[model samples]
Target: MSQAPVVGVAVFVVKGDKVLLGRRRSSVGHNTYALPGGHLEFGESFEECAAREVKEETGLDIKDIQFITVTNNVFTEAAKQLHVVAVIMRASLVDPEQLPQNVEPEKCDGWDWYDWKNLPQPLFQPLETMLKNGFSPFPAKLN
Candidate 1:
């Protein structure tokens, strides 16, 4: 039997014209500012995964979660193979001032909010696309 695909979740938290981003921990795409997210555990719902990943990676609690897109990522590195089905979501901050708890210190070097119009190109391609498209890729579905 083919194994169930690994599902991942990402959050694009926006306020005004700026969006929240996190720098990756390792060298896979090190020093790059990407959306805050991670893979889901077994039996966890997509919304729960989005909330958990955002908090773990950025120390931010997000609510009013909504789905965006479901895409498959096939990774080919050396002899290892990884298939990731990513679910993107939109959410509002519970409280920005609240210090993120249990953050993986080594995973992310920094976090910043960037203006959607002037995002740094070299480190943020996917984000650039998402913002440029007016966030149309994410449809709002409150559940």
Candidate 2:
């Protein structure tokens, strides 16, 4: 089989002043902090993929989904080189009081909410690039 880039949907599930992130236990970004997202399913909209991945990975529901940005990531450190086109999206939690649960412990250590200005170390490739470019998923406050 030939290597081909895959489209991955990443969600910025925000609550109050924080956004949800998890420490990945998967090979793509092992031990690196990342958003709750996964590969985009066939025929699914970006919003749909975001919602689904959030629920699957974090056991949380999100609403007000909207596209934010995209990034092209190529990882060569792994035994198998990987390339992914990350579709970034932002969404608010459906239940503001609900806490994230690590639904897929095999793939993620656990989920935590962190302020945008102070994220944890060793971010996933896409997220690292996004932050390096000064991209904040939080929407601008309207007066």
Candidate 3:
């Protein structure tokens, strides 16, 4: 049997009308636009991993990770079997004034704030689906 692919976490962090985005560096899909988060290191909780990834990639501290959707991605076109379990989280910014420097500049080409209603195509695809149709696997309690 083929090995199971790696699991990762993604956060759709929002502030006002903008969402945080990370321009992919040299990973699975280099130079692609993606959420500002990544995989969970061994021995780390999903929430902790989410926070650490956001801080490391986008120079932002995130807190209070709420449950979102999960994506099971299988890359069959790469000639190599790679599966990814992405746990999408809804988190908030801990501080807006103190954006840190990108720890891995090579992995993140740039960061930008785009309007939610009209996001660039680079930030489209699955993210657009997430925005339009949120998680429905479980009941969500409204405030």
Candidate 2 regions with alpha-carbon error over 4 angstroms: none
How do the predictions measure up, each by TM-score? 0.75, 0.95, 0.79
1 versus 2: better TM-score goes to:
2
Backbone N/Cα/C clashes per model: 1, 0, 0
> For residues 1-143, what per-residue lDDT tens digits would candidate 1 score against the true structure?
44456777877786656677767666455667777888888899889988888877777888888886665666554244566677888887888665444377687866777776676545544454555556643345689
For candidate 2, the 10 contiguous residues with the lowest summed lDDT are 130-139
In the range 50-140, model 3's lDDT, one tens digit per residue, is 8888887877888778867787777564556668888888777888665546677888877776676666665424565565665332234
Candidate 1: worst-modelled 10 consecutive residues by lDDT: 121-130
Residue 72's C-alpha lDDT in candidate 3?
76
Candidate 1 positional error at 38, Å: 0.6
What digit string (tens of lDDT, one per residue) describes model 2 on residues 1-143? 76999999999998878989999998878999999998999899999999999999988999999998989988889989988999999999899988899999999999999998889999987899888888888778899
What's the candidate order when arranged by decreasing TM-score? Answer: 2, 3, 1
Candidate 1: the clashing residue pairs are 25-107
Which candidate comes out best when scored by TM-score?
A: 2
